[model samples]
Target: MLPLLVLVTLASIAALYVRGDLNPILCDGPCGPQYVTPPEGLATQSPDPDEAAAVGSGPIDGRELAAAVAGPLRSEALGGRTSLVAVDARDGKVLVDEGDGAQIPASTTKLLTAVAVLDAWGPDARFTTSVVRDGGRLVLVGGGDPYLTDAKSKGSSVERADLATLAAATAKKAGRGPVTLGYDVSLFEGPEVSPAWEDGYVGSVVAPVSPLWIDRGRVGAGRSTDPAADAARRFAELLRARGVEVTGEPTETRASGATIATVRSAPLSRIVEQFLADSDNEVAEVLLRQAALKAGQPGSFAGGAKVVSQVLSEAGVDTAGLVINDGSGLSRKNRISARTLAEAMAEVSSTPRLGSILSGLPVGGFSGTLENRYVRSGQARGLVRAKTGTLTGVHALSGLVTLSGGRPVAFALMSDDTKDVNPFVTQAALDRVVAAMADCACGA
Candidate 1:
């Protein structure tokens, strides 16, 4: 009687499966009750707590932003002739504008150089430093890699084009003993030094421009007089270290034939970051010449300046009244308006190709050129990132900063023409102005 009862229950379960009236249970180890999926078009549930916290509030109020910056702009330390312009990066609306006319840009001119170079070559593009074998000679060709280093790596920084590595590889290909070493720097044309630059600038504020150099031609704090020759000499030393005997002096000439080994520069993006963050004058100059070459113009100061103006003008930024003497902005003759600088910042913020420029800016009270700035209490601190420029009475600060309401704004403040004022004072004034903008709650 018991066996018949069990059989009857099993037969009923089999009948339900055969009739397609049974719910399926899915399990890896043991079977569990089946789950009923919710019907389509069900009301959506809220996001988890972590995701909700990641969202930003909204745009800042322009009115409040203007109010925040007003007092700082009135500082007497900012010089008699001051030009300033701040715009909402989202819509290009002017938040603050004061004074007029062009002012000396100082190193902030590197911003213009950065844009022109990026326009000519995308961020991922890299400059090549190649060693080519022509006849009995080993030739090192410079592709204008300014940050090329001899060290394998500097701490955790990106690996640069290393001369020792290149030499070691080249020696393996070329038989040991009796090799003539030469370098080709003809990729760049015209004078190495910009004639428009101040006489004292060379070997002080900047080294003479050359495509082939190690450590920006610096022994330590001082610069070399002839960087190309010095670089070739260093290459010879590196070759000797690799058990290769070099015969004859290293001369400058173009290399033709098979490439032995090549090391590429840390991508253009990293170069831009280092140059802008450190305000590296020589790097800026080298990049300018490279930009000219890429644009199909002569790789000279004059040609670079011309192409930079053309590139910016074509991009719809007003280049009128803007004079670019040199890429590093060491020239006092280099003139730019606050409006133009602000527009350039806005362009970088909006254009995908130019976006990397913003990341290279020095963070306030944190890193690079701005490490010592914005240190005072109630200041912007890490809230601002900009390029600082200073020359005598001329001081300029320009870059992007987000307001309290999470809106990013681009600002440029140029103070010039004042006599006998301390540079630190002017810099402090400029920082205060930027801090005001960062501290704003504006149109929340």
Candidate 2:
């Protein structure tokens, strides 16, 4: 005879399946900074130019690189100031060093967070969400799974750990009697919302940085004010649906219980891929916390920022005058020199364990944030893989590009004084600068 637990779990699955509750849906679809439609006939997985370019093909010609980038840098579209640093990724040879002072970096800050987290936990590391029972109460504890979902599998849209699966497993173990559900959100420290954030950020830009959230704490089209409570409540509803009597509303409390059911998110490599390729702010913030926890620090803004700098410094990336206020670079307070950003890129590019830190970045003009960009730089298309940064007056691109001679170089380009200039014109100029570099075959 089949065990009662196995029979109960099977029954729950059939019931949910019959109701079509397990249908695969697009949760993280191309909405809100994830719109990555392939450019016409070219698919995202098409053979890339970088793959064909041989590594270590250059002893870059400093004077040639300077001459190649000079005209584009002087464009009036760049406003009054620009900072640029380009270095060979293989041997760390400085090719062109233009502003060496710390400057504001926008979404490109995800690069630093990606590198730190990847170093702390290798590409195969995963986050787990589990449930436990103490007496008659059940507690749902979150361990910072960024891709935790309340729906069914998301296919390739994302790496998901669906709560429905957990619900099915839990229903088999718990008794059918009434029981209270509790949730623990003590994994992360205070200040759920950053003080430096703009007023409009919470609802649209991102939701609160909670360790426990479903669908990134979304309710319809808006963000949830209390993601953990909402998640716990959902768990209770699922348990009840499976014939397990849930008592009152789920409450917040420190939980100590025996294991009941658990689920784990995809590997950290896949997480970092989504982060860089799509510039996923939620994942970036969660990864920063993971980095902090690895350093034995509290999972909060301050602790994460401190660890980011320390990790980079210890990796031999120059962190002088680097001020990291947040992991997503959404804050205007974050500052780092272009040279520092370039060095960080080089460090990641050369390290074997952190290869995704570069490979996962969106291909310029082909995918990710750069899909609409580089329209005018055909020669540079599919050749450049870089993280883009943008704010009101700041536009930055820090990434890797291979030359016509097959030499790979990491570059950081920032222009913060573009308030008076048209954004398109500045971006075009930036693209042209990279195109010029790609055309330079002076490595011989």
Candidate 3:
């Protein structure tokens, strides 16, 4: 018995010697060792994809990439007004900078619009454009109709909440076979773009945002009617063609106290995701209105812009010189610095549900407005992920990208004018800067 006890003591000592050391878990705030108890049915679950990829991986070497980019991305090539800034989102470190302090976020300003909407309206909150019966007249109240169509191609198309569904629901809900449908566009103004917006830029590729339409009156050349109303009428005609009796002509009005039916929106997150992914001006405007409405404010651009500004200030983003003329960055007067954009990007990156606001951006050679713009070098091909902005003389890109060092980085580049320089040339230079960050390991 004594011998066995002695042997046990020796084994215990050997086991203690075998235990080596543990690395410290970095934390800026109060943190304790987490004791994770396996939940039922999750014992075999794998780690999250991002976490797993990061485990035990060393930082990537990006010196070559940075040097390569810095080589051709000449300051002289870009208009003097051009500015660029890149940051590592994972560590909040600046990866690259060229006049990052200068404020001029063109369409990239929509990112702020997206963040405001998401904060005001949680990810799953949806927009609703309603069709209701008021006494004998059918009242279609516009709840700032972001998605009010049968065109599945558009960001705001509502298949289940469209005219047919409204008609069907109206028929079933009222116990009456049919009702006179009255349209109300009073929910939003004719367009989200202010009357003060530059006249020459109107009716261009990206037009003003109006609540009651789709395509901003660019459905065809020189078109300027309400796209939503047109769609609703077409839908009504379709219903008539399908044997649903129509009694009154569709008329446009504002939202009223009478509401009979509503086409609800998908949650705010999904809608924001779609809008940010494509920089959909109409979606941005509608979302801004929806945010204002949700926040108990008037659903107008001014009200929404105020709320948006408040949201930014609350998020610790500096909004000193920021001017948001419209939800989309189509306005020339809209100004935001690269630093502000980078700051907003960083904050949103830290938020839980924003999901690859970085990943959603247009990669140099891959997607969105940049798809055809930057396809030259292999480094620039897939390394950059950013939002692209363009007006007569303005071009910009802002968002986040993963550096070769495996650090997620936030970046913004703005070009006011090329001075007779081709826009493509400026875009290529921006792509090179992004590629440099992707290739360099900045110890982030």
Q: Over the stretch 1-444, how does candidate 2's per-residue lDDT look in tens digits?
A: 569989999999877544445533433322222333444433422334664354224478878888888988888888777888998888888889987488889898999999888988898888889998998999999889988899675444355687889999999999767889999989999688878777888878788898999887778977887888889989988888898899899999888979899899877877888878878777788899999998888899888988898899898888888988788999988998898889898988889789877668877776788877764445587668899999988999999877765667899999888977888788888888888887776555
Ranking by TM-score: 2, 1, 3
Q: Compute each candidate's TM-score over C-alphas.
A: 0.84, 0.87, 0.76
lDDT of 1 by residue, 1-444 (tens): 999999999999877654434532322111221432321211011223453344344555666777887888888888788887888888777777774878899988999999999989988889898999877898999889888877676432334678998888888988755878889999888998888888887787788899988888787778887888888888989998888888888998789879999988877876787789889898999999989999999999988998899888887776658999889999999999988888889888999888668878887766688877875545776667788888877889889876654567888889886557787777778887887886676662
Give the total clashing residue pairs for model 1. Answer: 4
* Candidate 2, superposed: residue stretches over 4 Å from native: 1-58
Question: lDDT winner among the candidates?
Answer: 2
Selected candidate, larger TM-score, 2 vs 3: 2
Stronger candidate by lDDT (1 vs 2):
2
- Please report how far candidate 1 places residue 127 from its true position, in Å: 0.9
**Candidate 3 residue runs with Cα over 4 Å from true position:** 1-73, 93-97, 100-103, 151-160, 173-180, 189-192, 200-208, 214-218, 221-223, 242-248, 254-259, 373-378
TM-score of 2: 0.87
Local distance difference test scores for all models: 0.80, 0.82, 0.62
Clash number by candidate, in order: 4, 0, 21
Which pairs of residues collide in candidate 1? 60-442, 60-443, 61-442, 61-443
Error of 2 at 277 (Å): 1.3
Q: Assess candidate 3 and give its TM-score to the true structure.
A: 0.76
